[model samples]
Target: MRRTLDEFNDRRWIDKDGYQYVATRLGEAIASGIEDLIERVETERKLRSVWQWLPDAISAFPFETWSDLTITVAEPDAPYRPVGRFESLLRETTTVRFLRPEVALMDLCFDLLYQLIAEGVEMRLIDRPECHRYFLSTYPNRSSEMIRQDHFTILEHDNLPSYGTGLLDDCVTISCYERDSGTVHALIDTDAPAVREWAESLYETHRADARRVELQKSAESVPHD
Candidate 1:
């Protein structure tokens, strides 16, 4: 389910704008599920989020339980660094692909990626050219080393949109995110096979079209000063 649907469906709760409405079982279940997930995903570091509005203590979710993970981060929510769940997902997934330009370059997230790469996880990162410039600059050496040992690929895009995602192993659990009140919203789903398929298929198209990122200084060799 995309955020658009939620925004539209949620409006049904209040026929009058901004008016509070009673919660139904389905609505409560959805809210409860979100809280439980945030608790698990944020297990520690205790990141306060809207998803954690419920009173119960959060539960810890193991990464191994998910066969796939797809993450989308709105630009507004790209800066804040999240702990726990991501670490687990990074460690568990044999293959991870990223589409968020800003988040992909953040140290909080990418710094932890080295360990996964060292452990033989394949990570394919895609982002806009400007955002990925720093990455491509220092990538040649590392790419040479890891490409042979593990799957390490970076692609350059010129005009990617605000919405972005990461498709993990097989297309099982896909995580969705947005922003409100300087906090990031989260959604992790395992039941949406159709969504998973669409995400993977979208990534495939990008993969087919994605070009290797590289830097070329000049066509002619620089003359001695």
Candidate 2:
């Protein structure tokens, strides 16, 4: 400890104040820079696993909002943690708009979504063709029933991000998945205005390019068991 202080003192990073030592202005500035670097590193650490899956727009987000995000990472012991968090958010929202590459909705979420739809909660979904086919095949009856409702809407977009973006009520969430396994690895949620704005913009852009999924056509496109 004494040797470290001597080194710092030699560099004028610390100065003697009677019997006590105080940091110099240069030392304070260096400390602040170090603190900022640590914060950036920590933020990167938290986002690294899911970073590749995130949309390009997220890269431009303000650094301050990164800390405000609620990142729910799937654990080895409980691999469904991210999905559970999203389901909880789904239950509370009256409106949902999402760009989905895959069907991350579990059985319970489908039931809750059904109830929400019957209660007139609005939902607009943009999904890839294969994912839409999978959903239709997996939940034939429910998909048919829900697609017929006025509150539910679907669009098919061939070029969607590997990750999913969901705008549930006022909150925005980015669901990252493992590419090979197709499992939800993390769910990043936030109410930051910048993120919400970006999400809404992206949703609208994709919605414009996507083809609407007609109830009759979609049903015929997929074979049932």
Candidate 3:
């Protein structure tokens, strides 16, 4: 304890008066800075596993919004936590827009998705060609049915980030996937307007560059025996 106090004194962070040491202004400032740094580090550690799968645009989000961000991570006992969160979002939304790189997130939600479409929810999706192909093969009847709906639209982008983005009603979500397995590992969502605006701009940029998919054309592109 003596050596630690001496080190603090040497750094001018503390002053000794008649054997009683008190923290100086510099000490308080340093302590506050260290507290913030530790908090940021902890947040990073929590996101480390899925960090690489998050959208690069997330870095531009205001730092203050990080605390307000809601993170739902999948757990061993509840492996479908993130998916359940997404489904709940789906059930309540009147509008849905997404940039999807993989189909895993939506694969299990096909029934709900189709029901939403039938209920006249406006939905637009920008996804990779391979993802569309896979979905068509996996759910031929439902895929065909949904695409024919006026309320649903599909656009194909050859390249997309590993992570997925969604603008569901007023909420914005970033879905992080496992690196090798391609299953959703976590979801980071926020209702912050600034974050939602950023997501909207990103979605528009990708949508503008993507090509609309024609149902017959897409189905024909898939190989058959």
Clash counts per candidate, in order, are 0, 0, 0
Q: Which runs of model 1 end up more than 4 angstroms from their true locations?
A: 1-83, 104-106, 136-150, 170-191, 215-225
User: Which model scores highest in TM-score?
Assistant: 2
lDDT of predicted model 3 = 0.84
TM-score of model 1 relative to the true fold? 0.49
Evaluate all candidate structures by whole-model CA lDDT and list the values in order.
0.50, 0.83, 0.84
Residue pairs in clash, model 2: none
Q: Write the per-residue lDDT of candidate 3 for residues 1-225, one digit (tens) a residue.
A: 989988999999999889598889999899999999998887777667666666766665656676567789999999999988989888989999999836878887888988999999999999988888788887777787788888899999887777889999869989989878988899888898888888888899898899998876666555543
Name the candidate, 1 or 3, with the larger lDDT value: 3
Tens digit of per-residue lDDT, candidate 1, span 1-225: 446545646755322236544555665677788887775565333223322431121123333333232333333545433333455556667887876535432334555676678877887877776655544344545434444553777777765544455677654333333433423344343434555555676667777777886433311122222
The TM-score of predicted model 3 comes to 0.76
Write candidate 2's Cα lDDT for 100-130 as tens digits.
8366644437787778898899999888777
Question: What lDDT does candidate 2 reach at residue 140?
Answer: 83
Q: Any idea what lDDT model 1 has?
A: 0.50
